[model samples]
Target: MNDTSLKANFLSFTGRAKILHMTWFAFFVTFLVWFSHAPLLLAIQESMGLSDQQIKTLLILNVALTIPARIITGMLVDVYGPRKTYSAMLVATAGLCFFFAAATSFEALALARFLMGFVGAGFVIGIRMISEWYPAKQLGLAEGIYKGMGNVGSAVAAITLPTLAIMFGGEDGWRYATAVTGVIALLYSIVYYKSVSDTPVGSTYFKPNKSGGLEVTSKRDFFFYLIMNIPMYGALAVLTWKVSGLGLLSELSANIVYGLLVAIYLFQARQIYNVNREIFHTPVEPVLQYNFKQVAILSLAYAVTFGSELAVVSMLPLFFKDTFLIPMSLAGIFGACFAITDVLSCPSGGFISDKFGRKTSLVILLSGAAVGFFAMSQIGSDWPISLAVVVMVISSFFLGSAAGCVFAVVPLIKRRLTGQIAGMVGAYGNIGAVLFLTVFSLVSPSAFFMTIAGGIALAAITSMFLEEPKNTLAEVMPDGTIQLIEVH
Candidate 1:
């Protein structure tokens, strides 16, 4: 089908298209609930008599759980399938939202916010679902639409929740607004569970051959997997250090958490060994082998793409307010334009990948992103505000598109292992956020932008090593028959 026909068919509410829409909406609602509190932080702080330190703690707690949760959710989706996994996550996050809304104390609210981080894992579930329904030719656009639209949830929350709070009209308006998100989450959980299936009719839903950790096809890949896992734990440690530096945890508690992280890494390494131990003694069949370099490179690329996105989105409003001498509201509007572009930019990246090639699209997008950020770093008070906004919008387009391009290659890696692969890649985005945000904390905005540009330059170079997906990827069936899925 031509691209125009495929896009027109995307509007129809039947077959694979329906699944695509349903899954993306499911992801959207989860993100809406996940970020519902961000735009209402002032209201939350005023109503609760919160100090700046306490509010910062709440922000830290919000993302602390997501890194590990994505890893776990990936494993569960691979084991239980997206239908069940997505539904359960929605239901659980609804409960957490309600808990957050009803909290009467800082401790209760912090715990609820921390637990709500798991809602972010909902993105990985839909990835596997979309991969199952769409062919390789259309997979990039489909996954892009799913991710790009779903990502709008955060922007939606930013745009709508404050207004909803005002409509409720009281000191507790934020609470009521938050409760509304919870109620919607509760209703949609049921809607999603009843409406979606793990795979299309007559198609097999591939599952991982082993559980606990991702199964690598060779000893070298096994060691590479372990090395890649280090950054995730390191990111968690950074969060712990940040929190401790803020005096949220005692030094003793911080040390204990550090020890716990080390122990967890050791345990995870053992799990990886247990899952791939056979590779130490016997070589995996050539047909089943996949390069771990693909996963590593994609992870690094996403750290630059989506990771910088999260960090930038969090700081952009402040950056504009301080640099451009704008009102908070107008600065927020400018900042929001960055995320809003995801609706178009992400799908554009994916379509470009579908029409051109994955590696080519990513390199071009990342290169543009590098240039965009470098330009942004040069902005100052003397620059026209409109020009600055244009620069930011351009930077956002390349960054969001690069993110879309990264995921376009994810589902093509290994059919049965798609969830785990998406999980690791997604987690790296968080790791990138933590890394970049840390740099922002220690440097000026210009320096921060320069650092991100440098990171993108590195990612663009690393992406040069990426091998595009071929025409077919082989998977073994229950009866030992080889099934080939079209990938190119």
Candidate 2:
């Protein structure tokens, strides 16, 4: 189908599409509640007499748990399905949100904030769900819309939560504002559960034949899987070390900490087997198999796109204030435009992928992103701020489109294993965030932008190997009957 032909795909009502919309909305609320403290940090710091280092720690604590959360949640999602799992997570996090809002002491808030980080894993669950709902030809756009819209939750928190706090009009205004978001989360969990089914009611939901680790068909893929898993665990370990402030292990207890790390690693490796073991012993029919390379490619693509976006948002306000010599308020306003672009551009990218070919669309977008970031890196201090803003927006569009394009094919890889695939791919996005943020910590903004450019080029090269959507494939039902499905 051409771009115009794919236009009709968006307007039609789909049970899976409705579920996609609902699932992300819940994800959106979780983010709002998750980051509510950020906008109100000043108030919180003043009220609690928090030091800069302590507040920074709290900020770090907010996302520190999400790496494990994504991996663990990926396993559970395959076993339990996104419907029950995501709703349950949102509801539980809502309770945590209440704890965060109600906490009077920094320690109490810190604990609550850290635990709530699990909710950020909501992004991984929906990836599997979207893959199930759409055919392969359109999966890119469908996944794009879901991720793009849900991702706006971060921007929403940044833009609206502070205004909400002010509207409530008191020292406790931030508290009241936060509680309201939590309440929305609690109520919406029920609505999400009611609005969506795990799959079409009559359609069989395929389950992984075994549980614990992901099985690979080839020994080579098994090694590749192990290699990919390293970053996920390493990211977690890094977060742990960061929290413990253990540069030399002088400030924290290393023995207990290393033991804790070992325990988590064993648990994660076991989970990898749960998803992969069956694929090793029982060879899938040739038609049902997907390349591990595809997963690796998308993971790297996400590392560059979503990964850089996350790191950029975290630093852009500082980038703005320092480069432009603007007030904090003005810098914040300039910084926010980067986020707003994700919402519109993400869906647009998805739509483009659905209308055009997924691989074709992705290649074009990645190429655009490479150029965009390269330009951004070259922008000197004497460059026009408005021109810089224009450059940033352009960069965001390419980045968002690339995200839409990456997910477009996620579901088409393995139908029964969609959850695990999405989980791994989604985890890579987090891994990207961890990787980029780590790079940012070590390098200058110019170097950071250049690193991202190199990543985009790598992803584009991988995109060359991807096969475009072909309509013939078989999805084996729960009953063990093969049903030929049209992917395009």
Candidate 3:
């Protein structure tokens, strides 16, 4: 394609483009609030006189609610629609932000942090919204843009909120600054609700036939789906165990929390079965008969990209402080490279897929990211901190781009179930974090890099199974009229 034609396809925002932009911004605010504590944790520790164990417990609490929250939110988005669901989530998140900002003790902080995890669920909503707007062929690139741009919210918090806290000054500065983020959430909820719709004009929004469950087309897929869900709930059980059962929590609290977690996971499993129960009797026909290979490959791809990032992000500050002898404050500034690269690389990754092809773009990106991680293993003991920072940024570019590569293809598979599909794909990213961070606990930095390389290589081989978008998707309405949605 010529430059003009490529520009028209990518830069077109008159219809879904505007909504894509708006939806990503809504996702951005979710992360901003979700991670608002990171930059202020030190201050919170200082002001609250918390013990090391309490601090660690708080960190565990931050992500504990998100696993099941995303599963439920994914189902809700399909039923209530992404537009309404996203709006309601924003309002709920802003309220959690207020609770967090006003917390004056360890108990309050723990409650607030757990509540904030709900914002992380917002990621699932936009998967459906973006899928509604784009066709199969261009789905990868468009979904990539929506995901990558929205992910920059983590970078934004890393870059801006701490400084905002400093500017405000005083012991309670972090609190006021956090409240400022809450204001953004409250205002944006209004903006997003008014600015976008779930479907474009003249198009009908198709709700899923089953609520609280995923509709499967085959018996094998039904079992496969259940196996996949194990990790989602298992990850939560792990977090709860770490918080209450391990040294982080007292023995008494751990036992209680563990019991609570088991109950919750069982409840969710029941819901999952409810959603997929129809497949046991008879398979449902697909709107577009694409292989699940694309979704499976993308899930593995993100495990390395976003997954490794999460593992590395939690440790980067300490890595800088130890390796380069930087102060805690400066270490944080340097560590920000891991996140800031998303603004560019994620979009660039998607754009490349649009220009070339999905499978090719992902293979290239995963290969480069493997090298980036390997290079990261070799930061010389005598190297200046700048060199290490440069290495991280380069690695982040590939990592962020690979993230773009994954989402660029997410929406193309099943437009109607994009939220559920994206939720599953997106959850693998968190799974990577749990698995990789566990490895980080056991090995040297070099081993961590090597393990990630091995994982990415596996993901690359799986990429072979993804088929490029072609022809048109056949959407059969309940009235038995079929509409052909063009992929070109």
Instruction: Encode model 2's per-residue lDDT on 1-488: one tens digit a residue.
Output: 35654343565456555666787787788787877788889887877788887787788778878776776787788889888988898898789989988998878988988898888888888887776666565666677778877877877887788898889887888888889888988899898888887876666677767666654556568768878887877777666666666243444465576678778777766776666666667776677666687788778887788888888888888888998888988888877888878878887787788788778888889989989999989877899999999999999999988887787777776666767777777777777887888788889999998988888888888888888756765666776788876667
Cα RMSD for predicted model 3? 2.9
- Candidate 2 Cα outliers beyond 4 Å, as residue runs: 1-17, 246-255, 270-282
Q: Note the clash tally of each candidate.
A: 0, 18, 4
By lDDT rank, best first, the candidates go 1, 3, 2
Q: Which stretches of candidate 3 lie over 4 Å from their true place?
A: 1-14, 136-138, 245-248, 252-269, 286-290, 326-330, 382-387
Maximum-TM-score candidate: 1
Clashing residue pairs, backbone N/CA/C < 3 A, model 1? none
RMSD values for the candidates in order, in angstroms, are 1.6, 2.9, 2.9
Candidate 3 residue 321 C-alpha distance from true site, Å = 3.3
TM-score of 3: 0.91
- In angstroms, the error of model 1 at 129 is 0.4
Error of 2 at 198 (Å): 2.0
